[model samples]
Target: MHTSSTNNDQTTELDALLQILTTQVASLQASYRTSNTTERIPSLLKLKNLETLGPDSDPSLNETRRLIVSAATQLIHTVQSPIEIVQDYAGSTFKTVALGFVVDVNIPEVIRDLGGEKGMHVDDISVHVGIDTSYIARVLRYLATRHVFKELTPNVFAHNRISILLCKRRSFEEIKADPISRFDDAPFAAHVHMFSDEILIETLSAFSEFLKQKDLSSESVKDGNPEDTSASGPQSSAGLGPRTAFNLKFNTSKSFWEWIAQPGAKYEDLARTVAVVMRGGDKMVDEGQLVNAITTAASGTPIDSSTTDITNLLPLVVDVGGSSGSATFTIKNKVLQDVSGIKYVVQDLERPIDSARKFWAENDPRAIETRQVELLVHDFFTSQPPSCQNASIYILRMIIHDWADGEAKKILKRLREAAYPPLPLSTQAVSPEPKTGPRSKLIVFDTLARYTCDDPRENLNRSGKEGSTSVPWPLLGNLGVAGEGFSTMMDLGTMVALDGKERTRDDFEQLGKETGWKLESVKPGKLAAFIFSAF
Candidate 1:
């Protein structure tokens, strides 16, 4: 009798929670002008967070949009989990096959070339794409159910917001058409191809094995390869290859860089894609913010006007380990005019230097002609090439956290040492130190994961639509997949691909303290964090 009463009480509590979720969902519909009780998916899909239906900032809509998404998520899972669990788990194979087919054959491009918003008939699309009509239709129809593409009529198809990404081009094109390369510099395509072909399959087989090999019984696997991170180990070329899953899978006795740098390595496309990915930092805090931080911090020390010589006022911006020099271009464009005689330098390996040179020559010839941007081949794990050391500003984007704290600190320490550049005496003479000036500032751009406990509805701006404010306990800062999304996925992939991990603000704090640098300020954005550093 007591057990029955307890069950009844628990069921009542769940029923109440469900009622709350349903009430909020209804409120969301009413606010969005779809309050009609009969409308089902049309209303559900209009919720904005669920689908990419394009931007609509209706003033009359309720401000707490995240609540609606959260409530709906909870309610849907509650109602669908029993049935969805089995299908979603086992059905991945079919979806993978269908997605792989479309990606491999460039179906998205065909559908796009045929008609984007208006869409194309299945027969016409198949004919244009040179695939069998019935087979393509069956696969697309299956994908439509998953919201990848849209089936307008029985045989017609249209590009949804998601499908448009897989097309050769983008509506908001951040990456440009690479005329030099045979493959399109399509970031999404590269991501899909790499994930589906290399990363996903490689990870599945090696993720478990790596743990077992590293002695899963001891949980200290969290410290990923301490020797590789230490000052001495990074200098040595031994025992670094097998530490990574990609190296292990390929059975290469070389580090990721050495392996990729070999002639005919066949990763040129992936290299281009990575350049696009590195430039993706623009989605977060404005590039100008970093520009402002560096320039302002380096200001106030004026050259003596009594001498009337501007030759001693040379300032340098070194983007350390800056693959492809993506950020370098942005920094140069933003501040080259404002800060006269400032030289922009991108220090990286031979591959990135070559890639950046090609990209910049075509993209921004002014930078090349003015001779403002110089690509220097220098390894970050070593001392900054003396030529670029003690620059006015040093920026590292996504460089740290590729190894354990031990290695991350070594990189930081080198940057710290380099920030105290020897003062150059005008034009031809070299001096030991800057006569009198501020130390160069080091700014790192990466994700600074943190739990921000704030009311979701407090900051009532349409910016709220970003869903980046503090989410409830279960969700991430971006309201991404309940605590496991791109960052988490990439974190794991880094472990396998490069033996790296993402760091929290605390981890950075420890790294900073150990590396002889002070944490100036942590500007956390919706996606990336701009961490400031000083000696």
Candidate 2:
């Protein structure tokens, strides 16, 4: 009787979820049609070519799509066998291996060259990639079953919407001519390669062993906070050098950055790939949104450049650890093109500073010639130079997630000291505030990690003030696979690679408080802008 009751309850829950899915699907269809000049939703097998009219282009459409995906995922879980789900999870590593294999061998490019939709036989593909015919067929077949590529026939494969994204957009001949620079133009492909190739794959393979063997050595324990002695999780040991799964696998004491910075063709290739991935991250948040975030954080109110003299109010914007000043240039060109006299400084290591000089020289020589922009070869771990101290704004784009809490604190502390330098011992008692001058703002642009369960703490925090799109009933608060997958994956990747983490809002607030900064506000998006003011 109890078994029957439980089954009936599950059936009722599935029916409710199905209804929600139907409603969401209808809403999505309507949104698509309205946004795309009354065009109908395309077939599943058809190639997607909607540029500005893509699902992500419209907010309502994206929200509806998330709902549908979440409902469908939950529905699948409801009916799918436990063993099947476990098997799928266990076999996912091969999926990554297969993806990395095809990308490395340039299968996507080969298929594109031959015939896009018409399809190519495995025998032909084998000739192009220099792999065994049967092996290529099996790999392609496996990927096809997962909808990565299309299987037009038993042993024939073709590029689909998903597979086409991995293309280098260069001719097969061009790729062959310069295989080293093939990924130079293909950020998405490079992204896949970086994640699936030996660097991450091999590092991740040591995760289980690394977890099982606890490092209770003095090196690990000394660097960590004495009060926070939690043995269940990984701890950061910046002073001791890299000690994560990456360190275990690579058998190196240097951090991932230091290791990658080593002089070698292989490291150079990996560095270039990293740069491409970072460049691709620009699409996460719009430049206009970033400008608004900066203005609000700097002035305590959003200033309209047309109405206010933004140049006079905010004299300098320091790009901390900014590689080649791409984000800075985006803000300058898009929003502050006409706002002259506002100095922009791009700070990084020697290599990136040199890259910045070259980039600016080719793009806008006047900015460099007139001294409006300065490229400084400075490390964030060190103190901010006298010239750049107490700037109106310091932008740290995608910087914080690269370090564990200990190192991240050091970086933030350096910025804090520069933003509000300590007063003399005699005057310190009279004035609690660090300085009489205008306070400098720190804007950290990074991923705002989300949780699957609905945490009320997030609702009460400043970072959570900007409410997310309402998830439908029965769907996870974060929309499960549809919404939080990338962020969670990134969290794990950072853990294995750098002993870093994608932090939640409370975590950010606590980190800020520890380093003598107060979290003032948050501008949420694909990459959130956590605005802080030195206290």
Candidate 3:
């Protein structure tokens, strides 16, 4: 009789859930109608961003995408059995294995070659990539269900938007000719390889072990606050294997980068792959580090170009560890037309600097020849004493999160040492607010690890104020599944790989205090401003 009552309760709950799902789907359709030009679902899939979109594409569809998918997923959860959920969860490891398989096989490329949208038979695709037809079909089928590939019919497939970018190589001319295409597809591949590959995923797989073995106070606690591992259920139970995870898995006194950099090391391929991926991934992720986020901090400062050479007072955008000047290039391209006399500087290791030289030479020789964009081959770890009188902004995008707090401090301290510059004579004045008196800032743009809330959907912080789309509920609370994919994956990935972490604003604020930069303003989306306090 009790079991019957419980079943009745579940039925009622499922009915309510179905109703909510219906409403959400309607809302999504309405939102799409308003936000997009096309009313057709197929047309929407062909949107320009879709050509290059991936886990971190800019001009993102964060808000709407979150709403539609989360609603569907939540609905599935409500209807699906507990046993089924557990089974899928356990079986999901095969998903990663399948991804690795196709990626390694370059299956997407083969599909494209066979005949892009028209697709080819499984046998042809298998023959082209030289894989067994049955095995390839099975793998392709699994990915198609997840929407990696479009299975038009039985044993036939084609490249959908998502599958297109999975191809290992891209035609530079094609990407350039089509301005709408994302130029960072190569780096995107690198990132995909980094995550989808065995070694990196191993770290994430041991997320459960990260807890049981990790000393809470080890200073190198992985990204996200130790106190808050919300939404992602019991993390100690999180890792499947008890013996190893994260730090224990890669037990070494040497840092992740150092270990990877060792001469002719066996992990060389992994390191090189990471290097390429890091370069490309920057283009996608750096857009979040808006120039306005920096400029807004200087909003009140009155700039009288007449008082000083306007050129001297022009804002400086510093891209520290900005590989191949990709981030700096975007900043320069965006700001060059509106703002005159602005200087863009990209500082990185020797190899990347050389690569940047080649890139600029080919893409915009005038910038390099004219010295408008300075590509300085300087390692970031050393003291970055100011060479010029004043640099308006030092942008450390996606850099600090690569290290533990101790090392992050070291990086910040170097910038703090270089942050303050003596005011240029013309602008120096007794006035409380000089519009253009060598105002300087250090901007750290990365994820501001928010605590996982029990009722994440309820506490959804629509960060429109910080400048990103807001997610309504049918969307996961923190967005999709309450900050599941990029947020948590990266947070944990870095833990095992580098002993680094994505930190909370409080964590950054504390670091500023320790490093001697006053936390001036914090815009949402993790853009933190620190003023140079060197007296």
Candidate 4:
């Protein structure tokens, strides 16, 4: 009888502890929900001094606010515990693409088939994705820590609303079906890319050594032969592995491309890595542009689109490097949904052609059958397609930053030749020519070089105020990038992987003038990207 009484006392203590935890979680949930709701509706007072959008705001701000809030809420709901939340944010970088891959591959469907979604005892997402369950558990556990998905119980998984949205499907009709389409699809292959522990170690090691080198010139050395692990640099690094040790011993002698192009090298890694970045990079860009458009289109600060003339002046627009047709689709769906005779052209490398064609085939029959949107496999480095000569607006998203000034000029010069080929001396205009008409406007969307951009911290400040930063999203918080890892990675990754560098607003202004494309204006958006226009 005494033992029974002691057991009841223990049960009473357990219930009290449970009550405290329950109250805390409830409080957290309430705080998060309130913060998220407030973020969707920016105060009119907050619009002052913003570059991306002006005091003149999109008439559709109310609608956009509603959609953005709903999406953000669902995304936040995926994490249930503080530990899970921190892990979710901590593992966000690697797991973002992993979750993306599962979505791309339809892993959730397989899980649903095995009675997992219906509350089965086991829901092993890893096995469903064809990997060992333990590995998947580790990956998902990290992901769950970040809130990408959840651990309903050990080894069992369930989709948070965010993960549910991630499942490959059309969020809206006539837009790109999968979010992956908007971006370069290489990120979907991140699982394969990260498998190269050698490359990761080498890259990290190289960066570390380069960081320590007192003389920047000394940093250019690399292993003489891409195949030779022995080409030398620093001393006393014999304990390291071939790749890491090699980096410690040598500096990169040439640009990254030159190093990677050495004979007998496995180019697959570099190529896929580029493709993955190119793909994932696109979504960040497109989302940034959408935000910019919503903010600016109403004010006409950039284009004076206040009157009906805005519609008639430049009705049709084509995105030169538009991947998966996301930008084109988003613009049409958001701004020109009811407008007629609007044609959008999405061009990209040959690899995306099949994917693009398949995308158009499976959805948007009007776009496909009527040719409202055309997906073309055209290289940006090559001549501008003849069809683009008369396009009212030309949009290139994140394409310019991939190249330096010389190559950028070549691309722009080609665009000039395509749009306004120089007339022979015999046909020269009698009077000094004035820039007028549609102007074959080229809209280049890219991030300005952060090292020099005037408002480098504008986005971060806004994001922090938005509440995503104040509380910290798990993975982002750890990375010190709770707001937007996409931009952060873009800035850092370009420095490490490619010779391509981010530019400043002044850098862009100068580059535009040098290339013959007159700079209309450069508008820095809320997402930390700049929308540049030249005609």
Q: Candidate 2 or 3, higher TM-score?
A: 2
**Candidate 4 positional error at 119, Å:** 18
Query: Best candidate per lDDT, number?
Result: 2
Kindly list the per-residue Cα lDDT of model 4 for residues 1-535, writing each as its tens digit.
0112234544553343344345544544444345523333333222122223321234223222322332243345443577867875675447545664454445544444453444222335554445666666676666667565566677676665444434322232211344333323335334334333244435644665545552444322321121212423211111112322233434534344344445653555454455565566556544545645534432332233333444234344667767677677777777566656666788876656676777667756578678778788776655667665545566777766655454455556556555432323442232223244334456677764432112423333222222122221111121223233345565545444442346655676666554445554455443233333333
Query: For model 2, how does the per-residue alpha-carbon lDDT over 113-133 read when each residue is reduced to its tens digit?
Result: 886788899999888889999
Ranking by lDDT: 2, 3, 1, 4
Give the TM-scores of the predictions, in the order they appear: 0.71, 0.87, 0.73, 0.49
How many pairs in model 3 have backbone atoms within 3 A of each other, for residues 3 or more apart or on separate chains, i.e. clashes? Answer: 6
Error of 1 at 364 (Å): 5.8
| Sort order, TM-score high to low | 2, 3, 1, 4
Clashing pairs in 1: 229-407, 423-433
Q: Name the candidate, 3 or 4, with the larger TM-score value.
A: 3
1 or 4, which is superior by lDDT?
A: 1
lDDT of the structure predicted as candidate 2? 0.74
Question: Which digits, one per residue and each the tens of the lDDT, describe model 1 over residues 1-535?
Answer: 0113234544653454455456656665555455333333333122232233422333234234554454455556666767776778667767666776787667777776656667788888776657899999999998888898888778787877576666645321212243223234455655665566543465556767776676655323544333344322232222354666676677765655455445653555455555454455434446655555555545532212332433333377788878677667776676555555677888777766788789888888787788778877777777777677656667877777466455566677677666653323341243222344455566777755433333332332212332333343332244433332456667776677666677766677667665555555555433343444443
TM-score, structure 3 vs. true? 0.73
